[model samples]
Target: MIKVLIVDDIPETRNHLTKLLSVDSEIDVAGTAGSGEEAIRVAMELRPDVIVMDINMPGMDGVAAAEIVSQRLPTSPIIMMSVHGEAEQLRRAIAAGAREFLVKPFSADEFSTTIKRVYERELGRREQLQAITPAPSGPQEPGSAEEDHQVVAVFSPKGGAGRTTIAANLALALMSETGGRVCLVDANLQFGDVGVLLNLNPKNRSILDAIEGGEPDADLLESVVVDHSTGIRVLLAPPSPEGADLVTPTYLRKIIDLLRVTHDWVVVDLPPALTDHTLGIMDAADQIVVLSALEITTIKNVRLFLEVADQLEYDRSKLRLVINRSDTAQGIRISDVEASIRRPVDGTVVSDGRLAVLAVNRGVPFVVSHPEAALSRDITRLARTLAGEPSTSASTEKPKKGLFARR
Candidate 1:
């Protein structure tokens, strides 16, 4: 429930506001203060989630009190209320660190929503601050006996290039191939869908939880990672977009390092753009699986990404270009695409829109659910190549119904 403290000099106004908030089942009135001075005292004592302070108080006005309260407890959001809807008053409230302002005679729904918004906003700010703060040093945990663990990052320069799908399926394939020692990280902090794709709840247990306690240990990481039915361990993204800012680049590095020590393979699903956090992950990855589709726009973005990678001094050998939906009859052949991008396609996932959509809707990896499908075979081959394992003898033979066979 949202804990709220009502502050108003008028006794009747305080009771009315408290009654209004009480109607909402999600909100609880922690306490009430008669004046701004009393409000600061009560806030310091209770540290309510939200403060509804009335402006134009007798002694200390709302603006002055809000500034002091904000300084004292930066995480608690303040909602300033006034009878006059003057621009100057709004400016003063904002300058004093009030998260929201309400003119008197507002409806209960509006009041409740404003409080909730401010509270959520404050929580996000707190999480971001915690993320940037250096974690406390802890005793180093023992590393895994296996020393050949690889960190593979799946990246796309544009959205809807099927990067997450590939990352999820690849991780599942690795888990099967490696005997259940794979970890998949949803690194697209702001709007990651790895959990949804895999059908994991991702609530409370996320990458944010792993790093929120400061220094990450193997135990912490293990506790936060959720197990997928496909036998892959997953570190999910934050439950809300507001919490994305909480996972800082420094925290991510520490988490990945810890994960590498615990899991045989760590597969990260990256966001479309190149942010500082994404760049850090790419720098640490043993292989960068760059994904592209048959669309001209996506291919162009991929080419640009390759150029940027070169400028960043990334080893060309570490980059693997995969064309998703390689069998699309868009009048563009794989050879033509290779020539256009000036690079050989390392892998191709055949397009089967119906099967792909069904797999996603069922929250099952395409390879696991439809092992006989052409898309599954392609992903399996790609996984094998990434794991540095040579393909089997059967893999050498051409498929009788190859999806990418030339017409």
Candidate 2:
């Protein structure tokens, strides 16, 4: 039940407010105060979930009482009542930390709705605060150097190729094998699935929180990146799709650069298109793990994206081609994929539909939950190769013009 405290100078007004709230079974009128001073006393003692207060009161007004309550009891949201819905009164109430403003003579519906909305928002704010894991503030490690950090970008020319799942698990595998700080970035922007795959939510706190104030810094990054129980930090994409427009390519690159300095490995999951935002991450990444499926259309797009990467002059060693669901070739073998794309497959993950689906549904990385499983072993081996084993493959092919004019 939502416990509420009603504060008003007039005895009749307080009684009427209590009566109005009494009709709702979900809300319980825990206390009633005739003045703002009494409201504070009752609020501290009762510690109600919501406080309905009059903005105008004798001796101490609602604004002053709310500011104190907000500081002392942040979880108890205050809803200010006013005689008029003027802008000035609303602004003052907000400045004093009132979560909502209600004009006088409001119906039971509006009053209850406002209280519920404010309470939900306050709960979300608390969750966001508890999720973020601040960065380490001390000096760098004894023998650490600038070249020690690695920024790996997981990309796929086609969607639904398990790019997000691979990225999330790879990050966990890296953390397990290397025992270093790993930060996973959901650069997919619009419709990112990283948070869902990891059982995390933005809760109005995402990369937008890091970039809104000004140029992002290590301190800002510390505030927005959330910590997982497995010891990996995640930078989620914006909560909504339209919020993607506010994140420019420059800001994305800046955030990537900042993360590389603080983390041993920064894994960024990219979208399927060839947009500027994707290119910015590609340019900043030290290695790009391109994911492909065992299907005809997926192989075709992979070929085209490789052509684009060649035109952009990405070094062959920088690109690692990995085929997902390789066990279900269905007359299309791995050799066909290699010959079709004219590139060797660096790694391949077997198709285990049951385990993969179960892992995703349970929001646990297979590498952590079932380390000895085939899928988990595959990802762990790949992680070790990327972390410790350097690739010897180099491209002898020449860059062809007009593959992508923009490049």
Candidate 3:
């Protein structure tokens, strides 16, 4: 049974919640508290699987109580209840380490689902930590290679360059080409679109769970990631931007180190900026695919990124340049783009605006829906190249009924 602690200042609210939760056979009301301070004390004693606390409690608010409880019992998940759905409240709740948030006047179904998801997520995290606590042999040192795993980071210095789209498709194609041993990480912590692109529900569990769990081992990392239908394991970003601050560069490195041990290939979809977090991932990547469009501004940003890569002494051979929308009739040839960036274009994905939009909206990748389309063929060939297999030239087939074919 799932043990839940409900906290609210009002007696009626607490009783109502308890009654609503009691209808579910799987849930048990472990205890109830009238204020944030009382809730913290009760939580410490009860150690419930899930804590549902109201945000507007007198004296001590839900945010303060949540922060304390989270620090004290990192394994237990907190669900913040608020009447206001403002962004600030959501941010505060996430900052206080609440795993889930619910607005007031929610249905019984919503309440039950939130409790169960939080409970299961907490249980999984604890079990994972216990399973990987390094036996009597002691913890393994860093840089100890379990096996040879390739890490690929898909990046773009400019936003709207379709980096997330390319990254998702590349992961799918890699899975298809390599017999399904691929992991895709959404490193765009603030606003990652990988979950939306692949149609995955990124709630309750994310990369933040792994990082906040202290030290992540292979089992811990595996437990946090969600497996997609395309045979790709996804480490989704935090559900809100406030949760991103919890993930530091050091934590990301540790997560990647653990992930590389379990998967054959790790594909990271990065944010547009080269923050310390992004740099940390790039430092571990075996290959970096830089994406750019045909626009002058995008090409300029790519050139600047190339210069920075040189300054950082990155291996030029490991950095591959991909020109998205390569077939656009923007008067600027692919050769001109390469000349501007001072690097040869390793791959090019043809433009298919309608298909791309449709795929994103329908939560299906074009590579799966339109495998025969020119755009899909390009992604497939690019995947082969990244996988160290010989790839044929881009397909010349034009997708029928192409509209607004610009990246």
| Model 1: residues with Cα > 4 Å off, grouped in runs | 1-146, 389-407
> Cα RMSD (Å) between model 3 and the true structure?
12.3
lDDT of 2 by residue, 1-407 (tens): 89999999999999888888888888999999988789889999999999999999988899888877765566788999999999999998986768898999999888888878887887776664333323332223556764677888899999989889899999988777776689999998999898878766534458989887878877988878877645688999998899898898878878988898888889999998888788878877778899998899999999999988887878888898999998888789889999999989989888898988898787777777788899988888888778875432221222232324566
The C-alpha stretches of model 2 lying farther than 4 A from their native spots are 1-140, 390-405
Question: For candidate 3, what is the TM-score?
Answer: 0.61
The C-alpha lDDT values of all candidates are 0.80, 0.82, 0.80
Q: Rank the candidates by lDDT, best first.
A: 2, 3, 1
Query: Local error of candidate 2 at 256, Å?
Result: 0.5
Tell me each candidate's RMSD, in Å, in order.
Answer: 14.7, 11.4, 12.3
Cα lDDT tens digits for candidate 3, 1-407: 99899999999999999999989999999999999999989998999989999999889999988877775566668999999899999998886778999999999889999999888877776564334222322112345344446778899999888899999989888767655367899998989888789766544668878865676666767777886644567899988899898987878877876787767678899998877777777777878999998889999999988987786657787788999998884889888997887779999999999999999997778887777899999998999888764222111112212112211
For every model shown, the clashing-pair count is 0, 0, 0
